[model samples]
Target: MQTPLQFCPRCKKDVAFVAAAGARTCPECGFQYAVSEPPNPGSFPDRPDRAGNPWLQFLTIAGIVVLALLGAGALLLGILFVGCALAFRG
Candidate 1:
């Protein structure tokens, strides 16, 4: 019986899958197809092992720093205003 041809990376061409001894193989190069399913294309690994976008992280951190600086500036200005008011009240 004939089978559909699958591309063989080792053989660099499409070849028929030959079934023998319960395993499918490339006819020309004798490359065996794995029984297990391959991983999906462009899939992410576990969170710890996966890489995230560096630019997004950098922007998030930068935004937080800017907000924090603004908060600190407002706090300092409030303190200065309170001190000046007290000094002139005497």
Candidate 2:
């Protein structure tokens, strides 16, 4: 039986879901499968969306830290300029 078309990451095209062995099999490469069952199916999806991705979280925190550092540096520079102007004022 054929189901609605799903996004195929490998094939990079929408393909109908082919129910085989209680998993969604890829109709193109025939290698990847999306096992939507339990009891140790032991198969992974073609396009894995890992929610708890450590690398992604780490990169996001790193980006925020970098932006914070840049803002602090700019603030320090402005304070130094203002202090220098006040000291040299006649």
Candidate 3:
């Protein structure tokens, strides 16, 4: 049995597909493609752990800060509108 040759996008040539150690590499330009193993549904983890991802935490904190600032601005505007209305009435 022989594996079908695939077109190499980088080299722009037809090359034989070779697989070794869960990866496919192009012979011409050395382009690598990782072969992903299918996850076992029964053994899957309950939840993804994001504690190690600091960027996501930073983004979440930044979003909360922005929302808080926007709420403060809206409250300030409301207070100013009430003050202007009271002044105009008097």
In model 3, residue pairs whose N, Cα or C atoms come closer than 3 Å (at least 3 residues apart or on different chains), thus clashing, are: none
Instruction: Rank the models by lDDT, top first.
Output: 3, 2, 1
TM-score ranking, high to low: 3, 1, 2
Off by over 4 Å in 3: 1-48
TM-score of 2: 0.44
lDDT of 1 at 40: 43
Q: Which stretches in model 2 have alpha-carbon errors above 4 Å?
A: 1-50
State TM-scores per candidate.
0.45, 0.44, 0.45
Clashes of each: 0, 0, 0
Q: Give the per-residue Cα lDDT of candidate 1 at 48.
A: 19
Error of 1 at 66 (Å): 0.5
lDDT of 3 by residue, 36-86 (tens): 643335453334245346899999999999999999999999999999999
Q: Each candidate's lDDT (Cα)?
A: 0.72, 0.73, 0.78
lDDT of 3 at 3: 58
In angstroms, how far off is 23's CA in candidate 3?
22
Q: Ten-residue segment with the worst summed lDDT in candidate 1? A: 43-52
Number of the top-ranking candidate, with lDDT as the measure: 3
Which residue runs of candidate 1 sit more than 4 Å off their true CA positions? 1-50
